[model samples]
Target: MATLSSFLLATSLVLAGCAGGGGGNASGTAGGGGTAGKPHVLKVANYFATDHPQNVALREKFKPMVEEKSGGSLQVQIYDNSKLGAEKEFYDGVRNGTIEMGIPGLIMQADVPKMAVGEWPFLFKDFAHAKKVLEGPIGKEMTDEMESKHGVHALAWSANGFRMFSSNRPIASVNDFQGMRIRMPNIPNYIKLGQLLGANITPMPISEVFTALEQKVVDGQDNPIATLKASGWYEVQTDVLESKHMFSPNLYIINGKLWSQLTPEQQRILEEAAKAAADYEWELLEKSYEDDKKFLQEKGIRFTTPDESFRQAMETAAGPLYDEIYQTYPWAKEMVEKIKAEAK
Candidate 1:
């Protein structure tokens, strides 16, 4: 009798533990705590400021959409303005699975050289053209390589807008570029572009840009007008040239391991939320340009829209840089051709 009672107690305890596990609303695909019916936490990181359209889109669209759609099984936490770390830091975190998600610029071009095309000088004709190419088949081709090589999966493409030149003096033509000190990202394309334009390039990270501008470490910096307003770089810049030399885009990526752990329904909800948020950011950013330009003007900053001649001159000077890129990467030439063809 005693032996039978012991076996029965053991069986009862085992059954109770299994029952306590709670079958977890399709989170059965995940391991450990996630299978115990706990809400899966996803941390989203980015360097964009809180008021910037990127953060606004994430907060208003992504968070609410994912949580509601998952019926409280998925929770999203967003860290904006380098709250977690700078672009590279969070990017590395995502790649290593330390961070669930990140919105980063094409900094991955350092590892994934093909990504450089995203920022090729004078490549994208306009906002619409860039968006079409990036969100179309070409973007998928590029991002597929990213998933296979790197450990992150691309969710959606967000807006960084076009790169504009901001300076203390007017840059109305190519002549103004000569001997000017300009800040550029350490990326070779950016440096080569600045060098081609006859400026002395000071390669630095974006985090250090404002101090460099304030201390006059460099004469000017180039970034999207949205970034100009978000980072408060406009306070130091007295003039802005709507140069639109390059179209910069941000990517919403999730760690491959974390993404794989999500159930199909959870993955679908996250992907849908990402696209919605990306579209939201794009709309908000486009509408913000004129408002940012107007605010900069009201702040005693001069805004210059370069004429067609000046634009042509800059593009002409950049021809060799593109030629050199084609020589370096066998696939680059074809990619550019495809991008241009698709733009039409």
Candidate 2:
């Protein structure tokens, strides 16, 4: 009888322990103590400053929409101001899944050589033409190639606007570029374009540009007006030439492995959010150009609008590069032709 009573007592104790453990788990799940599966965390990186339109859209619109749509199952963390890394490092991080997403600037050509065609001097007629080509069949082909060749997926194409020359001296004509020391990004196409324009090239990171201009390390730098204003280059620059030399595009990319890990519903939500952010950023570009130009004028910067003859001179000088580009990358010519045809 004692043994029977002891067995009953042990069984009751085991049942009580089970019930206690289950109750603890329920409490944890209810109180957000991680008993429920942890939400997936996505890290997005960009080199733009926080106040830049792209970052603003990503942080304000993209993040909230994604979180709300996912019902707290997904969380987006943005690292702006190159917090994650510089352009090349950001691309590497995203490709390797160390960073889930990135919007890298001119450094993309380092990974996919054919991408250089997109930034070819005088290639894009205007923002609308550029957008139409990049968002159409040609863009899809490039994105597919990116996925197949590199371990990255392109989500959207956004712009950095047309690059203009900012300098201490006025550039009213092509002759004004003679013997000028200009800061170019560490990219071959940029170097080539600077050389073609008869400027002494000083290849440097974008971060060093302002100091370089102030200290006279470089006579001038070329970038979108918004970037020039945002980087405070206008403080040292007295004149801007509306060259519209290159229309730089920023690609929102995701790590292929990380993308594959997401559920279909989650992927759809992310894709839609990315598209919305890109569209919003595109709309901001026109306003940014007007606002930045006005702000620069307020700061006593003079604007030089180059005439058609000057533009024609530039086109003639840089046109030979098309053949050189075609020879260098086997697929480049075809892509360039496709974009050109689409633009028309």
Candidate 3:
């Protein structure tokens, strides 16, 4: 009888231990204290000011979604206004994994000349044409090229709207630009456009443009009306031409390796968030142009709309530059032709 009782006691103890073991696991799965998984902290970097509405909207819309989807396992931090460094440096940081995210102007990729085709002055006819090209295979090719060559993955496409000509002299026709010193972003097509018009191309960073214009280093620079007003360029500039010369695209890129390392679930969240942000950016683009034009008129800034004849003259002058760029990168010509065909 004593031996039987001891056996029963041992069995009861073993079953209790098993039950306790199962309970502990269930508690851990429920995210119990002392055994929960570590949280992931993501850092986003951009050259836009922290107060920029785009940045603010992105954080407000996506930050909470990330935390919720990760079950409180992820947190995102945003650093803006080159709080890190120049735009190029921020791009390099993301490429090398020092920074996890970066938003750089499409023209900035002119550092990799093949990418300059997107910002080629007079290349895109309007927003609709540009959108068809950028969201189509041509843009995809450039995005893939950046990944293969620079180890970065592009997210979504956005824009800075159309660029206009701003200078002290009123530009009523293409001939008016002869011998003028025009500020050119460090992009090849822009320089070519200026050269075609007989203007001296002054290559400088956007941050230095105000001082350059104030000091008469450049007779003027080209940018969207919104950017011209937001950047305070009008304070030093006297005339604005609604040339609509080119459209600027803004791209968000991440390090390829880091992106691949993310879990599929995390990747999905990011892609969806980026698409939403792209839509929001488009809305902002429309409002920005409208608000800016009103403000510029009220500020007594002169606005001129070049006639069709004048537009054709400028385009004709840039024809050779386009040919040169096409010759240098034959692939660009093919892509542009392909985009044109798709639009038709």
Candidate 4:
């Protein structure tokens, strides 16, 4: 008889308990670090730039609300731009209880391979379709498995937006993907997609991408367009392929062990704040796409929208990969069907 709200709250009771290292230079904080009546400090780690919506939401929504609503019993300290570490490192930090919380992407699939569903290329129809599936039963099903098997818990699903390709050259057709040297995060979904599209996939971490692009080590890279703007990758990149090839969602996660230690009231406050912050990020990012495209245009970054034929070709290229997924995860076919059904 539990409603969705109750389920989310229960799942998010999977939040912080580990006190992070000192917070003297954290991106945002509502309390002094002097330790008077010492509130519980929740250390949040993410790799997004300080100005990115992820950090903005955390600073604007999550930090303040958790601090205020908990009546200062809980304090949030945000470490933006890998201040704690990169995606995998911070993720491991959360898993081992060295850190309290994080917003990592498909890197989580390393531990929980099924989590790959989030970044599967060309799977999502659009933002609304994604929201329905990931926040509904399907998403809960995945996150529930994630929490039980992995050590981190999902607080809420936030937007990373749809990914676009930016490069030194234009991606005008499915043929352009052939032999293109594209940088991809070292996850199987990305690697397989790139290979199938005939891209010469170059795997690397996000931190090294700028240098790689500037040095011509790779032809291009993929990320949300807003990320292209926020990370300032546009300075060296000349064109964007509005592929929207994949939609990646960032889950605000807390240490599973730490989550269990919190009192019910504290858990409720954190859950509300986390979801509110995630929603705020989604709002900011949805608006940022067009705004960011305009900004990129102003900077002389050209844009390309794949026409119907090209899109179909790209989807066809992805067909074999989906077969592999279905073969690997017995339930992926059913889950994917459920996802497609939502679009109708």
> Which lDDT tens digits does candidate 2 get at residues 227-332?
8887888899899999999988888889998878776767777888999999899889767888889999999999988789989998888877777887777878
Candidate 1 structure quality by residue, lDDT tens digits, 29-82: 443333223468899999888899999999999999999988778899999989
- Highest lDDT: which candidate? 1
Q: Assess each prediction's global lDDT (C-alpha) against the native.
A: 0.89, 0.84, 0.76, 0.86
lDDT of 2 at 336: 70
lDDT of candidate 3 at residue 177, scale 0 to 100: 92
lDDT by residue for model 3 (249-331), tens: 77877778888876666666667676677657666766667678888878878999988898888889888987887777767
Candidate 3: which pairs clash? none
Give the distance in Å from residue 250's predicted Cα in candidate 1 to where it truly belongs: 0.6
Best by TM-score: 1
TM-score per model over all chains? 0.89, 0.86, 0.85, 0.88
Q: What TM-score, to 2 decimals, does candidate 2 have?
A: 0.86
The CA lDDT at 312 in model 2 is: 92
Worst 10 residues of 1 by lDDT: 29-38
Pairs that collide, model 2 = none
Residue 38 in candidate 2, Cα distance off native in Å: 6.2
